[model samples]
Target chain A: MSMTHWQAAFAARIARDEPQWLAPMRAAAMTSFNALGFPTTALEDWNYTSLSSIAEVPFTVGASASSTTVADLTPYMINAEWPTIVLLNGSYSPSLSSLDSIPAGMLVMDLAQATREQPALMQQHFGTVATSEHAMTSMNTGLMQDGVFVHVPKHVESETPIHILHVSDAAAAMSAKFPRTLIVAEAFAKATVLESFVGMADVAYFTNHVAEVVVGEHATITHTKIQRESDLATHVSTTEVHQARNSHYVNFSMAMGSKLSRTNVYTVLDGDGGGVTLNGLYLGKGTQHTDHQTRIEHAQPNCFSRELYKGVLDDASHAVFNGKVYVHPIAQKTDGKQSNHTLLLSPDARIDTKPQLEIFADDVRCTHGATVGRMDEAGLFYMKSRGVPAETARRLLTYAFAADVLETIENETVKQALEQLTLERYAGSGNNTAHAAREH
Target chain B: MLEISNLTATAGEKDILKGINLTVNAGEVHAIMGPNGSGKSTLAQVLAGHPSYEVTGGTVHFEGEDLLELEPEERAHKGVFLAFQYPIEIPGVSNAYFLRSAYNAMRVARGGEEVDPMEFLDVMEEKLKIVEMDDAMLARSVNMGFSGGEKKRNEILQMAVLEPKLAILDETDSGLDIDALRVVAEGVNKLRRPDNAAIVVTHYQRLLNYIIPDFVHVLAGGRIIRSGGKELALELEEKGYDWLLQEALA
Candidate 1:
């Protein structure tokens, strides 16, 4: 069984002399993961995605790396603007990382170091934000190896973004990485964290990552995740967030690579006058399958939430988006809006979208919808009739579709990089790009 | 020069245009006035190579080459333009960008150099003034959130940029007020030259008053039943289309 394979593998790792406070938590997570097992289509949340393919592949935790150099990773770096923390095959790579001028009262180190140095702080916030309800989150909790932990003290806004790069070093054998991240922002603090995943193409690997974020009162946080794993890899990521009073939180998850990927994000506005925005962009091509599931919970009054997820699907690819906005009965004057838009570029592409809104408060306002539309034929013809070629017209419309979501990004450095990546995706897709218009 | 002989086209198993014959020389404007369902717009779209219409029997020779054999953009590159009856709204693409791309494409299609955005802005500013449009309009998405008058004016702006040899204005006066109609018509008049021609298709003589046509023809039953001088539009304007339809039947 899949449960026995993971349990026996992780038993050896945790058997090492670790912190007593963390040992029981991992054991309980293992128990829950074993009981829940892997989700199937019979379950409502897992209806559109199947794990049979991932279940068949043999996955090992924290496998050793295979000669990955810094030069090989330069293509994935964000270039001089920010400090980077590098992880190679789920292990901290200090030789590849560059961290300078770290602020006081802030911690930017591996989870192992935090467990040893700041055990009390780790005990207070590590497992508090994440729950082991989902099987995959439980799996990450039980077997997660070395990952980064970031903590910002009150009113110490980060001047630049902090980059976290996760690189998979797999050769021949199917390696697995259970990366765990815990971030905490004190009251009135502001920070932006960029999590980027990069790996080799056609390498069979598994990356199950879980990130837990907590924002104190009046704090603001911008958490961005860029998942560019190998096309032959299986990526399942879950992010859980909780915000305090008068806080603001934003989650931007862009998935452009992987054979099968699923991103599950859950946010709760626990404090009055708090706001949250959940934004995502997915580009699915070939036989890739991408799924996004988001849930926003407004538990307090006068809170606001906006969620927008857009997907572009081509070839025989499939995309699924399920967004839910829930307002509690006592949460009066709450405002929430959710929208999902998908553009189908080929006849074989398929999309399934569902926007669910549950509002129990009579004074609250909530609206949600989903749209699956093809490229505008009349618009394309109009552009073509103006002398723009049909092929360039198609690319223009597709680029416009992606830019709609990218333009809303708040960070300039990240936004420009995303725009460049989107253009590269388009140029790479048109195998006959020799005919593409390069006249300026 | 443009010439069409016995052109017949169908839209989804029904003939929208049947046996349409017309010709326009350089520096000439031929106005085709027809009643509703008389296939006026179909003729315009067919000439511009719209794929929705199937040309079953037709031979359109634009400057002595078969125009129907080319794609829509190819036809546009060959100096065939259609000012749409309803300009489509394309969100997320600015008006100036769309215009520059179209203009550069037309240039490159005929073996000319493509202009950069900064270089094309000079040309665009001149044309925008003709349509009395603001620079803000050029920055917004094409036709998105634009009023009817603004959309019509944008069509003229594109025309002034491309400077097509054979321009087909399809019902350009449908949704415009008088002031906007004046702006659009004046822009067309300014773009007219000795080497280019235009076909003004409308249902009323009001537009004809601004842009005087050299030849006015009445279309009925999918054919040009009557062809006369510009005075024909004034006569039809005063009497409506009933007498013309009855005369065609007789």
Candidate 2:
């Protein structure tokens, strides 16, 4: 697991005349990645998720290839009309992506290209928010080849959302892919971006991803990450957000796939009147495992944050939610609320939820709560008394439980689409026709 | 259409209904007036097959079949409806959805096809007007944020839509205003048919004014101590249950 061997080899293989500042940052990150191996259950954050399944993955860094075609990558694209960036095996696939209609003065390109073409701009903001501290993050920073870099200048807004799709088409049993995304919204600017991680094959691969979002004063940003990898793939991603004075930031993460997936979302309200809202929904079935570890820090006065996460566990699948909110000494008038609720359909399925709040300021108002239970018996009885079969009753109740979270999405079309997908996911659980008939 | 024989039931270690015997023919409305904890609700719950109460010795025949042998849902499917006194609040379930499910459940139990949403909505639109309830309540969650009067009216709406053979109103007039009470009573009176019956359980005679009863019975302790025509309700309202309890004891 030493980095000395791979650092020299990676440097020799990459093209010459690359940005000078990136090499040392990558070298230092590789050192940190080597020092800290994969986290284990002994750590409180990783207690419920078992990383031993991915410990022995035979992973090797992949090289860029030009033969990748858009037809091969069409299944993973969510929005075809928006400016698109496609990354294959952690390398930019120029032939498969298009960015024709981007507004003027907005910078949207591969981070690797941004580093080579505009070194000064890349040096000012790259790695500014996501530090190389944890092993997965450090590995992403160390071995990162190509990702998205989006910059919206002051007072500018984009009409359409930027779409970035990351596909892992690796053939090796233990191949590794590292993807990084860096976005900066200047003062009074607005933008929406969606990042999707998908796997084209069912091979056992590992994807380590890191994204950094910085919102300036009076700015607003909405970012969404959708993870739908292969059944045998392991995904670990961290999204760090820093909100400045009077700025608003919203991040949504949906985990529907991956054998062992964990997402860490960290938000910091760094200035006065700043607000951030974090929302997530994870649907796990079969033997899949999903974990969401979220932390929100209120560092200044008049800041607010709300976190709502929900999960539905079926079969023998397991879900974990560890959400923490911190109110610092000067962060008064901070209205923070966190709630995590889960439904365990099968007796064997499990969910571990903990909502933590630490407040040092006496003038702040913060609340946190968590609930884990089966379908409401009274509710089921009431529905059954009406003529709904027991199975349909269960499905309706389950969908309603998740709908409480889906209704929070601000976009009408996205909210409706996600709600339909949520219902379909429940309907796919061996009660399709019954649920479909009930819906009508 | 309904018969009870030796109906003995208990909640925990205390007996609530002791060997209660009564019978109701079709097209009759019977009123049961009792003091607090005199087993008025116990009779309604036991008849509805609530799992909390244990039936030590009882036999209920509804439409010539053993009613106590069936589950609560089965009892409901067999045309036995209990309008709760304190209706349970079900969050996240729409009122329309709840009523449609109940209506379809009863229909399917009788070997009929289930109604589609559009047809069910048409039926709800017609029945909701009977209770003077707005269409908004039907779209909202069942009893989640409804006022007391709204909840009771919603119950009557369910009764109108389901049209059960035996409708048991267990203290449905407790928290209703005068207008809500009149609307609910009118809804119930409209649903009455020669082939259906009702058992109105209450502690006062106020509700009987809106929907006149054919018979009134005084339930003291666990058994009916007196039975008379509708005038008994007016008499009880004038003298109260204490005088009747004293008369029964004497």
Candidate 1's C-alpha runs over 4 A off are A101-106, A171-173, A427-440
| Candidate with best DockQ | 1
lDDT of 1 at A316: 95
Chain A of candidate 2 compared with the true chain A, TM-score: 0.92
Report the lDDT tens digits of candidate 1 across residue range A260-294.
Answer: 89999998899999999999999999999998999
What are the clash counts of all predictions, listed in order? 0, 3
Reference-based lDDT, residue A294, model 2: 94
Judged by lDDT, which candidate is best? 1
Each model's fnat? 0.60, 0.25
Candidate 2's displacement at residue A320, Å, is 2.2
Per residue, candidate 1 scores C-alpha lDDT tens digits across B1-250 of 8999999999999988789888889999999998998989999999988889999997899999999999999999999999999999987677877888899899899999988767887887788899999988887888989999999999999999999999999999998999999999999999999999999999989999999999998888788999999999999999999998888778
Which candidate tops TM-score? 1
- For model 1, what TM-score is found for chain B? 0.98
